[model samples]
Target: MTATVLTIAGSDSGGGAGIQADLKTVSALGAYGASVITAITAQNTRAVTAVHPVPPEVIAAQVAAVLDDIEVHAIKIGMLGGPALVDCVAEAIAGFAGAVVLDPVMVAKSGDVLLPDDAVDALARRLVPRATLLTPNLPEAARLLRDEAAGDGAAMQDQGHRLRALGAGAVLMKGGHGGGPTCTDWLVTDQGAQPFTAPRIATANTHGTGCSLSSAIAAGLAQGMALADAVGRAHLWLHGAIRAADGMRIGQGHGPVHHFHELWA
Candidate 1:
């Protein structure tokens, strides 16, 4: 049977991120993709101009529709617009027996605020504990904890542990925002922290990298790979995707990584 992954995220008109990116990543990893849109954004590679949240009732209905019929192996969640929506999504998936990959999309790649200031607490209170793997970049991790972002590897591990205390089965502290010759992502589980590092590629076209990575990890999990193995495969795949990102030239600002880099070559 084909592995199927459900993506619950906002829609990005530009197709570089959100539900678009998640579906693309899932397909590229040889998994089937399903979706439940929580919101819609008037956005491009440059910035998000406007956002229209889907009504909570509609969002709930979509979730029910998907879960009722499909044998979804894993769920990748991103960009719940506000507190009520966060609670809505959390409750909807409470009985799901598969892995849940939650990508706390607090900020867009273009530096736009996707999650509101008030909704942060709601997300933490309701959804954080339900995550099988919590994927948070530096600023996101800081925002979730109401603390400063980590400045170093040790700090990253500390933050990961702190986040795990909130009840995530594993926390992947993404290091893409860090400035350095190498990029490092820490995966913290009950066993301990394992670091995945790659040479940093200098490119402004990193728009949907975080979304892609988390989605790819979800796809891996859907295909029955172990969490660490899933993370490792995604790390390698994203590195290649980023290396090929500059060639796409999709927009005037930050473009998306090539989700189909391997397939195209």
Candidate 2:
């Protein structure tokens, strides 16, 4: 059977991030993509001008409508705008039997805050525990752990442990934000901590990288790949996308990665 992955995220007019990036990554990686738009943003590669959050009821309805009929193999969640929507999503996917990959998106590439200040607690208490995989970059990991000083490798591992304490089945500590010659992502599970490393690609076209990576991992999981293998494949794909990003000149400001690079090549 063909794999199906659902993405619950906001819409990015720029098409570099959020639901747009998620769907593109899913399809490019050979999985069926479905979406539930939790919010709408008037954004571009330069900056986010406005945000209009979808009503909580509407968000719930969208999720229920999709799960009722589709046999989704994995669910990738991003940018639940506020506390109510977070609660709504948490309740809706309470009994989901498939893999759940949560990208705790706090800030956009333009530094716009996608998640509300009040919603952080709700996200931690309600959604983090339900996630099969929690993908957080350095800043996000610090925020989730409530440790503004968590940056070193040791601290990152501790943050992973803290997230597992919060109940995630596994944690992928993204190292892109960590300033180093080599980008190393640490995957912490009940079994142990494993590190995946790749050379850092220098480019400004990294706008939708976080969203794309989580969604790609979800696609791999939906296709029945093991957790470590899924993350490894996602890392390789994202690295390639970043490397190809400079060619796509989608916008004047921070551009998007070439999601269809594999196809174009």
Alpha-carbon lDDT, every model: 0.95, 0.93
Q: Which candidate is the best by TM-score?
A: 1
Worst 10 residues of 1 by lDDT: 117-126
Candidate 2 residue-wise lDDT, 122-227, digit = tens: 8889989999999999888888877873567777788888899998999999988888789888999999889988999889899999999999999999999999
How does candidate 1 score on lDDT?
A: 0.95
Tens digit of per-residue lDDT, candidate 1, span 1-265: 8899999999999999999999999999999999999999999999999999999999999999999999999999999989989999998998999999999998888889999988999888888899999999999999999999999999999999999999899999999989889999999999999999999999999999989999999999999999999999999999999999998899999999999999995
List TM-scores for all candidates, in order: 0.99, 0.98
- What is the lDDT, from 0 to 100, of the residue 260 in candidate 1? 98
